[model samples]
Target: MASEFISSDIVSILLFMSPGFLTIALVGKLYGIAIEMEQFEKTVWSLIASIPIGIMFVYLNEINSIDSFLNCFLVHPLRSTFEIIVFSLILALLVSLIIQHKYLENLSMKLIHNKDDGFQTDRTVWDRFMQKNIGKAAIVETHNSVYKGWLSANSSRKEKREIVLDSPVIVYVHENGNTEDFPYGKQIILFGEDIKSITILEED
Candidate 1:
């Protein structure tokens, strides 16, 4: 059954149109998810698998004399089959983006700013967040102080219990808890025990 399906015209058209087949690769690149060779593979495979699943949505054509006319018209490069393949893959990509990016991103406050965690399985999920956000703005609050700075640390879960901060700025909070930045510090090493909480700030 699998071999028969693989030999079908649907798969043939998809394979023949290989040049523009995975437009979802471009989409993932736009979203910054298709970086490096490993992630590129993931993005392409996700879309490749998605294309056939997407075809299920297209509703198979009914048998009739018009089928011959349609087939004749589709013999050229820009065939009706190509159109079906492209549009179905795109719709599937959209749904895939929602599920993999938006839904999973916010599912457990798992990523910074509730955004999709980009291509990285380098460490634990939270650790991966820090790895990707290096050299970006961050706000760290400890037991005795608040800080804002460009994150200079490259921390992984394997490191166990510390995060390094470089070029840190002190943030002073008033009685009502409104904070003002008083940028200060050369470098600070924060032990996990001392950290009350840390927020990776927005990058402009």
Candidate 2:
């Protein structure tokens, strides 16, 4: 009897704890966060986060007349699970936005009379600078070539950073120190490994 009860409890936990786990996983992926938690820690955190979601589910169900249809066996489990999954996804997206943009965090800090504008982000200095300055005209230099273009996209990773330039021009330097620019009418991708320097031109 006790064994059967234990098995049922385990099944219930596994079935109902998906929202919390899904939320955490989605948040990490969306915001590019590295989550390193033990199984026990994951379980505890999932349980904690799942509580509010579960309460919201119950409140919505109570307010709506869908409970009558949800009581049916075919509709109850599957539809309820789908609704919870959707709610979890929305919550994860909102959480990711809050963390990535730091809108809520900065507002809270200001409300609390903190001096800093916002919390320190978990991104590299290059990533932070480029994110704000992308779409600006810049000069990128490599071992063999120099490119002038508008910055299009930049990778956020610390290693093997890559960037794309729109409407690039290749600047060739002769041995006599004279420079010539040849317009390359398409986008060009440059790898961080070969890049020597990048200079962002000031706005006119």
In lDDT terms, which candidate is top? 2
What TM-score should be assigned to candidate 2? 0.55
Q: Model 1: residues >4 Å from true position, as ranges?
A: 1-21, 37-44, 47-49, 52-76, 81-89, 92-101, 108-122, 125-164, 167-204
State model 2's lDDT. Answer: 0.79
| Candidate 1 TM-score over all chains jointly | 0.39
Error of 2 at 49 (Å): 4.2
How big is the positional error of residue 196 in model 2, measured in Å on the Cα after superposition? 1.0
Instruction: Report clash pairs, candidate 1.
Output: 169-184
Number of clashes found in candidate 1: 1
lDDT of 1 by residue, 1-204 (tens): 867654565555554334233544555554556434466665576557555533532344332333332444346436545655666456546646775667856654464444465633444765766767877777888899988777777556566667777888788879998978775768888787788877877656
Who wins the TM-score comparison? 2
Error of model 1, residue 50, in angstroms: 3.6
Pairs of residues clashing in candidate 2: none
Model 2: residue 58 alpha-carbon error in angstroms: 7.6
